[model samples]
Target: MSKRDYYEVLGVSRTASDEELKKAYRRCAMKHHPDRNAGDATSEAAFKECKEAYEVLSDASKRRMYDQHGHAAFEHGMGGGAGGGAGYADMGDIFGDMFGNIFGGGGRGPRRGADIGYVMELSLEEAVRGVEKQIEIPTLDECDSCDGSGSADGKLETCGTCNGRGQVRFQRGIFSMQQGCPHCGGRGQTIENPCGKCHGQGRVEDTKSLQVKIPAGVDNGDRIRLTGEGEAGPAGSPPGDLYVEVRVREHEIFQREGDDLHCEVPIRLTQAALGAAIRVPTLGGEVELKIPAETQAGKVFRLRDKGVQSVRSRRPGDLYCRVVMETPVNLTSEQRELLQQLEATFTGEDARRHSPRSSTFMDGVKGFWDRMTSS
Candidate 1:
């Protein structure tokens, strides 16, 4: 059987970032983990599929090659020697080490903290114009008391239980297995005197105030990355990054589609009959738009360089204005009489010339009725 698409296996888009890919992989691995679904071959196969997809997509070179060549890049020696092999001999141990945190297992290593995401809501104006915003994020930071050492004296000793290995061996019937040390929690070390502030965790939960600079022309779903602004790592390890996602609120007057902006402008019936110049709202300011004489309703006018400027290209887009003629309402008796007298002028054959679209539509309807009766 053929392998599934890597992105499909991980349930992510091709444009997914490293953080998104990691999150998706974690979700899949957690759901399909072998230990979670014991004796289920389907679940085991699914877990392996996710793992293989993650391994290829997580690597920069491998991902690029795969993108260019598809699955062929990883087969027939294209992925290079030994890469094509499905090495699942020690899958259990490998997965246990990778996802120990989720399963309450432990391992010894300088693990980077998990990345975080924040949604930033913006008005249409704010999205068009660059703005700096202050935001608060709650996460774990290095404990000040022990300076992230986890010890009151800033010293740690090798764990006697795991013998500095961070794992202990135990016999289960016919097989022997290695598991994290219960005493050390897989750190392979022990804090003789835990820090009073953070116990032995080496981190403290706190809310951090940060200023994020948003660029102009950012659309919904655009992300801005802030390096090292995520949760602090354990034992002074490297911290992760923060992703600020943008969501633009719906505008009352205008609707945005890509770089273009569209709006409906209501024009008076007199203005539609006689050419007139009217003011319309644009992102920058109000601009004059001229309507030609006898302009029909729903006529679209394009105003160049009146829309949003693209963030990537720095090129301004056009604004499309669709005109709808508004009928006169609440007229005085004298005004109504004058309008009625004016309407009498086009009562005969002149009405066809005055209302050509209505005349053509009526003609089509008559033709349809004649054909239906004849048939």
Candidate 2:
């Protein structure tokens, strides 16, 4: 019988991108994996078929050949049998490409430690002015007992399974494939006696306290990276980086937008009407804000260079203070009498001139009454 089309097996079009092909193959493989299916031969066969299809379709040169001349293009030196069979070298390349990310691949060299993130919560004031803080980070560090050798005797021996090749070949029908050795876990070396401390892992969990200097004007969600501060790699590889993400707590008095600071300042009705000088709090210090006569509620006052400084530019931002006029309450008899007299005097003036909004609303009410009585 003729072999099925590679795209048909993976359920992808020939024109699919490498990412799309990989996604389709991953979905199918995860669904039909032998471990997931557990003794289902049909699912295992389907999983292998999908893997083979992805191995060919994911590669540019192989895909081009298969598209141009079908499976016959690999019959000569490409190591395919009469009806499309892949060799051990091809399978090794596929496995390397797939598991390389998981195993950390830099040309089959030493693996680096995994990068980690540490979240640091800061108050609004701390974020604006910056502060030095000490953080405890739990990470994997090199074991000091066995000197990170992962062996009881601080010595390593060649793997007996793959014989230092790191991979083992297996024949499947007419195709041959190579997979990472389970014995050595692709390290190509074996520890005869595991390290008593780290159990041959070469790294141990430890909490390290590090002092971090937060830069001025770092906003919420900003990240600072410290190189070589993350977990140590196995044996002698380079350590990964540690990312410090900043989270600014909400402030009760101020709200930050970009580099600008916004705050609501409540002033008495007398202060809004007759005008008064008030002290407003800023990041730098307290500043006097002059409220002009007839200052209405919701009036915004700008204080230049009183906001947070920019992390990149180092220049300061402005602070905006919005005035909220508060109504006076708990008036004594004398105060009530004085307010009543003032209200009478103001009412004596032309209604349009004294209170335009009140005059307009009264006229509308009168018009509505007239219409209702007439109807």
Candidate 3:
């Protein structure tokens, strides 16, 4: 009998991606699996046919040949056999790939340790300027007592269940699923006598102390990866990485926005009316800000190159200082009398000329009252 097209057999299109082909093959093969449809010859034949289709399509070379020439590409035995493509002959390995990532067991060897994340808090000054800090973190470390072997007399026996393979296969419905051996815990060996310190785990809880260098201009939420500094792997495998995430505490003097900094500069009422050069606080230090004559409240003054310079962008930003007029408080009788005398000097059109905003507001109030009475 002539064979059906591989794409048709697996119920997938020729342009299907490798992942799509695998999903299609998995569905078709499992539906017609011999184990599921026992004593059904049609289902068994369908299963074998789908498996053959998957084997050919899964191999890049075989897939290219099959795509160009169709079934006639392999008219005789095969250009390449079971070794070239995981055909129906190797059900063990084929099913292992299909079910591995889904169930977490495959031909790939042991896994490494889990990565760890540590949040490091820093002040605004420390973040802008680089600093080195010594940090201590609690994690699993290789047991010095057992040399990470978990065996007490430096002796281990092959696991009876997995037969030194570290994985065991079991029939799950129509599929054969594999997982790490319970007896060996994926180590392929069992301890004759467990270590007293780590018990048979090959690792123990320990504190790791190291000096970490935080680069300058690192903002909040930035992370620094410390390679191979994470928890020790299970059974002496390669360790993982440690990530240090930076958290910048709020500053009292300045508010940082991207590279620029903003701060409030308070000046006396007399200084706002007349002119005065007042000192303002910055991240670096205090700087002199010249207030122009008759400078209004909330007037912003830009200081060039006075803000933070980020690590990524080397260009420094400007500092914006908003002038806040300070009202005199708790004045003595003489001071109150002097303020009253100053207030008396301004009258009528002269007061209007001095405070245009206040004159515009009174005019608006008059207009509003006129409109209300008319309505």
User: Which digits, one per residue and each the tens of the lDDT, describe model 1 over residues 1-375?
Assistant: 988999999999999999899889878977986657878899989987897797678755457657977776545222212222234325445555664454333534445666889999999999999899999998879888999878999889997766676655432233233444445545778889988776566877779899999999999999999999988876676788999999999999999988899999999877998889999999988999999999999999999998899999999989999999898899999989988988889887889999999999999999999999999
**Candidate 2 per-residue C-alpha lDDT over 1-375 given as tens digits, one digit per residue, 9 for 90 to 100:** 677899999888778987788679768977986657878989978987886676567645457657976765444322222223343557646565665443322233235766778999999999988899999998888888887778889789987766676555544344453444434545678898988777676777789899999999999889999999998876545788999999998999999999999999999977887899999998878889999987878999999999899999999999999999777899999999998887877754564676776778988999999999999
In model 1, which runs have C-alpha deviations exceeding 4 angstroms? 1-108, 159-188
Measured against the true structure, the TM-scores of the candidates, in listed sequence, are 0.67, 0.66, 0.69
Name the candidate that leads on TM-score: 3
What Cα-based lDDT does every candidate model obtain?
Answer: 0.79, 0.76, 0.78
Clashes of 1: 0
**Residue 53 CA error for candidate 2 (Å)?**
24
The TM-score obtained by model 2 is: 0.66
The lDDT, on a scale of 0 to 1, for candidate 2 is 0.76
What's model 1's overall lDDT? 0.79
Per-residue lDDT of 152 in model 3: 73
Show model 2 residue runs off by greater than 4 Å: 1-107, 161-182, 357-375
- Higher lDDT: candidate 1 or 3? 1
